[model samples]
Target: MDPVTSGILVVIVLLVLMAIGTPIAFALGAVSLGALVLDQGMGELTFFGETFFGHVSSFGFVAIPMFILMGAAVASSPTGRDLYRSLDIWMGRLPGGLAISNIAACSIFAALSGSSPATSAAIGKLGIPEMRKRGYPDGVAAGCIAAGGTLGILIPPSVTMIVYGISTETSIGRLFIAGALPGLMLAGLFMVWTLLACKLAGGYNSPNPVAQAAAQIKENVEGNVKALIRVLPFLLVVLGILFALYGGVATPSEAAGVGAFLCLALAIVVYRMWQTKPIANIMRDALRESVMIMLIIATAEIFAFALSSLFITQTVAGAIADMEVNRWVLMGVINIFLLVAGFFLPPVAVIVMAAPILLPIIVAADFDPYWFAVILTINLEIGLITPPVGLNLFIIKGIAPDIALRDILVGSLPYALCMILGIVLLCFFPEIALWLPDLIMGTGS
Candidate 1:
């Protein structure tokens, strides 16, 4: 069978399985095993365990769970609420201030949690109700939280970046640093769109004067100060970990370990979560998410390996290289492919299966790998709110069941457009993603 034909068939089968609600890990594993068996006979099954194990048996992969733990620790606490309250107090006076505050809170919490759904859940729980209370439309309220949550993957300490780094043999620290500026840029875009949207909708403030007075009272100086005091330590811990990683003081895994411990400690001290249940809940949430991600990584590795063994990866890369198109044209095509892939698969799975195949082609085309990383991340971030498998959409629906999914979807579309705009801007000015990494690491090849 031709590699292209086989690849298409494999993808079709995988999609069918997923369409029928098969879990991603199982779908990947089953399809890969079938591909290998057909290509190399039943004997190929013997090496399956080793292939899967070897893919995940890396010191670098340890960072995923640790970063997840860090996020879990913070998500399991009241940190999201504190962070939201603090931002709302400061920014909520502006037109659509509440919506903007949710985006800002999501960015900060993204740094803390690094999981979109977790960020959405933590912030949305508080943000959605507050925004709705302030006369923000349900679609806008849910949309902002859902869109903001997507920031988790683009920000530093991102688990998806770690996965991309490990898969492509790129420096995790450089990848993390590479993400910082673009993450902020994307957040700023979300805020800008939100402000404009709110203004167009006659502002986000409630009409009731009594409610207005209560909002002002709630935003009092003392409460804002206390909120900041509670949220500051977690922010410091994230910054310190990034410093340690980029400064070469520690490896990604070491930085993550220390970061996780400190985040858990802060949750304990600030929230007084001395009891076993909250602590156990943190560990439990971390374990569940970590296991799911690890399984996807392991299975996706087998899938990638099978493609390589069957010459599918090389065939695809070679065909693209042979196209002899302009680098920018190639990038545009790649971005379209990535956008579609992301709409279906989670970022980790997409990176694991596609990055190895795409990285060489990207480098060959003279694109900066670090810059491409940010673009790829933002592409997947948009996927978190898109349809059929938009995880953040469901999370928003889960939190605010009264809000129509269409409203959430409608609300999130503009933010997705903002991400697309961010990508286009990055294309024109690659430095938005590259400058920080270059400054810290002294340039890249």
Candidate 2:
């Protein structure tokens, strides 16, 4: 068989495996190995080691653990609860008051933790009960937490943005800066949905005002502010990491290593939670996650290499070019494809699989890949909150099982629609994404 035909069959087989419940990393590795053997003979398998070494050995990926540890520190420490209470007080007066607070808290927590599940788990723990007590529907509460927590992936210092940058060879700093606007934009969209849903459902039910019980809420808010003040050292540690990288004082990988140590020291000073118990546990956990991701990346890279070597890029690109659709129309089409596929797959895999295929068309149509990337990330963020395999939804469900899956999924509809709208707005006007990156990185350097 021709390389193109074999490559196409390889991908189809991989998707079949994935649809049949095979793990993503395994599915990718299996097809990748198959492609190498069938198209180029087992002799070429040597390239897998080189590919693995080149991509996985990078220091930037260290941010995955650093950010994860920071999340764990905040999760296990006293500070995490306060962040939620603070956001709750500030945004809780609105319709779906606690739901609004969920969005606000996720963004704030994203700033602190920079990981979606961390924000989801932290806020979901606090936010879910608060909303439940306030007479909010269980599904709405769970849905808000699930959707809001995805903020971690898009905000600055976001592990997803960092990973995307490393994998795509785009500037990590630029991707970080680029993500700022769209990340916040998506957050804003969620806020709007929370408000509107709560507003529309205003007539559904009424509860005795919990205004009196708010004494504890107010106290919690104040405590959160105080915790923020104490956590300033940790904040400084993170800020210094980002500032060093963005200001060109350090490369991203170096900053990641430095950032990890700085965060550990800050946790020690402020919380004094550092002992052999947590330290050993944190390292072990970090190492485990790191090893898993590194292995997946290694295998995925080999898979990507074989597929591309078979002209998958040009073939897919040519197919799209032959469609001869207007560039904007094509953007819409790719985005819709992503949103639909997102319902079934993890967001990262969706991006990895599609980016190589899509970038060529994006370039041929004169659309900026960076802009497309931000737009693509937003669409994937929706997937994280959407039904079926939506990752964040399950995170909340695990935390609060009394909440029916249908409610969480149904409550997510408005927010998901808002996300779609956000994507459309961004597609029509690229500046929403490009503006901040342009200011920070200065014209594609």
Candidate 3:
């Protein structure tokens, strides 16, 4: 088969496998194998071996598993729970306040983890039931958790940025810095819209039922604060490492390792949440998840590697470059297309499949990568709330299986609109993304 035809066939097979519910890793590997065989006969099987090994072999990839471990550790231990309860008390007075606070919590966790599904799975365990028991609307309850989960991509330490940096040969450190302002802006948008929506809905926030007692609210607040105080050491440990990395005192890989160890010690020794059984369980779970994510990453590498080799990516890039529309018009079209694509693709998968194509066009037009990354990240965030294959939505549903899918789906729309608004606001005033990167990289925009 001609290479172009083979690449096109590979794309078709991948979409079919994805549509038919093949796991993403297997779908990528399978499509790659099919393409290789058609193009180079059975001898090309060796290339699959090479590709698989090459994908997992990067030293930088170790950061992914470590970050995953740290996220899981915080979730299982008391630190994350304490943080949630504290935020809950502070925000529980307003309509949908607890829900909005949950969004805030996910945004905080997002800075550390950079994986949306992790943010949902972790925050849902603490946030969902608490909000429901407090009489929060079911759909509003579930929507907050799902929408908040998207923070993991927009925030600093984002795995999406790492992947983007790696793919584009940009500096990952700069990408991390680039994401800071935009992540917070998106989170702020979620909160503002959520506040308005709750007021308009009139049935959203759980009354300060406990808080009306004054004494009871005070007790809860004090207890949560004390618990959070105990968790501060761990938070500090993680922060210190990232801070050093950010200030150029250490590299990201070194910081990740340090952060991982600090989390382990805190989880086991300080939090006292670790028993032998739990420790074993944590390792097992972390390993299983890490392997699944790594497999997908590797397969994506193969697909990207081969696709670029065939210049199919270039063909797609050329098409986008040829369009002479206004940049705003082009951006709007790009964002709308991405939102539609996000409905079908996993966040990382969307990034992998689309960024390469869009990026060259963006660069040729002299648009900024950092700004584009933030913009695309926001688009992917909306996808998490989108229907059908909205992965975070389903993950939250899995946590609150008792909650109607309709409820979660219904609640997500307002938040989704808020996210879209954020994209538009950022599009017009890109300073939201550019400010921090400028300050850090010394490149005044």
Best by lDDT: 1
Q: Write candidate 3's Cα lDDT for 1-445 as tens digits.
A: 4556765777788789988999988888787777666656898777778877875787777777777777666666766677787787778777788888898888877765667887888889888898779777787778888888988887867777776766666667777877887778778888887787667667465565543688876777689789768767766866686577667887767777777777777889877765698777667767887888778777877777667666676766666677788877877888887888788776676676678778877787778988888888888888888876888888988999998888889988888888888888887898887887777767842
Query: For candidate 1, what is the lDDT?
Result: 0.91
Model 2 CA deviation exceeding 4 Å by range:
2-8, 203-210, 213-221
Ranking by lDDT: 1, 3, 2
- Candidate 2 local distance difference test against the native: 0.74
Which candidate would rank higher by TM-score, 2 or 3?
Answer: 3
- Report the C-alpha displacement of residue 439, candidate 3, in angstroms: 1.1
Per-residue alpha-carbon lDDT of model 1 for 72-159, expressed as tens digits? 9999999998888778767867888888888999999999998899999999999999888768889889999999999999888899
Candidates ranked by TM-score: 1, 3, 2
After superposing candidate 1 on the true structure, give the runs of residues whose Cα lies further than 4 Å from its correct spot: 206-219
In model 3, the runs with Cα more than 4 Å from the true position are 1-8, 203-214, 309-311
What is the TM-score (0 to 1) of candidate 2?
0.89
- Give residue 251's lDDT in candidate 3 (0 to 100): 70
